[model samples]
Target: MTLFTGLAAVAHAQGMSVSSSAFADNALLPAIHAGAGDCGGTNTSPPLEWKNLPQATRSVVIKMTDPDGAKGGGVVHWIAYNIPASVLSLPAGAGDKSGDQITVGKNVSGAAAYRGACPPVGDTPHHYVITVTATDLDPGRLPPGLDAAGLAVALAGHTLNGSTIVARYGR
Candidate 1:
């Protein structure tokens, strides 16, 4: 089986909690892939589709972070802000563009792009949680490089709702 497929198997066996319509629950991207490094075979953003959002949702915020990252504070792999609520899906490679309506934020590597999971070889699998939040305001106002804490501060009272999808991978 391909690496992606292998990763999916692990997620399934591990009981990851994510929306069934999102990539973590889909069969296509069995694993999460990011840009850069030997572990980064592809720069795709993993297609994402969601529903059951509230009516006040003007935009959505998508973020992928490795809570079990090698470092202590965890790692941010991907962040896309100001996604119009009308948009139901983010096609693979959506993060390829810079400063688009779908803003890309800084990852763990300090770059404004996705850095896929590439744990030290032979290490245990790591869990990556991909979360989507429906906001009452536009995500465009938020600037890039705002880590989780920064994001939480900016989203103080504007968050209408949210959801999550989790996937696992390791090398």
Candidate 2:
């Protein structure tokens, strides 16, 4: 099986799945969800939904990364964690600076908000991988303002199950 299929199987076995209303898996991201700068879009975060989390889950973490960004060194567009397990979805714009309920972590740009997809002009469309992880940690276990790397370090050994969706965007 493909690596993605293998991972999906694992997640399915753990009873979790994630999806977005703004785009299908492996589909092009809408311009409304692109960055507002040179990318020329509205910079709105897409709506996301997840379900069937593991019974032991106490919190959730969401991360979006552009594997092709920054000279092939991956860039984190968003990191949100410490979300109550009872929350099954995030509405559009929920990644904004003023978002509530969930703790917003810093993105690659150091902003505790979503930085929508913005690939370099003329490059092939870049893939944005968004993952939602269910963890056993309490909703308030993690502090705010942690960046992607820091979040990763904090999440070690805590993830119980997770799911991922891939969207493409380009200038």
Candidate 3:
């Protein structure tokens, strides 16, 4: 198996799972999580669930990125951090600012909110890698409004382990 496949197998064996109620693993994300505008979606955050996090975990950071966005690396769709370890799941539309359980960090769109897929029309479906990282960073200590790149830099030594669930979306 390839390294990714092997790692996925290992993660599965470890019982660390990140899942979504709106769709199955590797399935297409629902329209609620789709990007607004020409894509025509409500742009709500999909509900997410996780289990068997590492013992050292103190917080969590949930993010989503489109791997086939025709960009060099990928296009970040969401970056939400400061999630308490006690919280194992997020309800649909939880990314909204009001009554949100965690801090929704800045995304590629410069909005600190979930902005779903808006891939170019006629392009192949893009794989959106939704990752849930368990980390040791204290929410209070983290600077406010950190973007994906900034949070990634801060999570270097703090990350314990993570789970990834892939979903697809296209225009």
From the highest TM-score down, the ranking of the candidates is 2, 3, 1
- Number of backbone collisions per candidate, in order? 1, 0, 0
Give the runs in model 2 whose Cα sits over 4 Å from its true position.
1-13
List model 3 lDDT by residue over 1-171, tens digit each: 599998886675467789999999999878778888787577888899999887667888888888787564788888888888899999988975424448887878788788878888877778989999988876555766888889878988898888999988887
- Candidate 2 lDDT by residue in tens digits, 78-137: 888888999999999886663456888898889888888999999999999999999999
lDDT of 1 by residue, 17-99 (tens): 22643343423334446444566446567767777666677888888887877655687888777778787777666764455
Off by over 4 Å in 3: 1-13, 98-100
Worst 10 contiguous positions by lDDT, candidate 2? 95-104
> TM-score, each model?
0.77, 0.90, 0.87
lDDT of each: 0.68, 0.89, 0.82
Clashing pairs in 3: none
Give the candidate number with the greatest lDDT.
Answer: 2
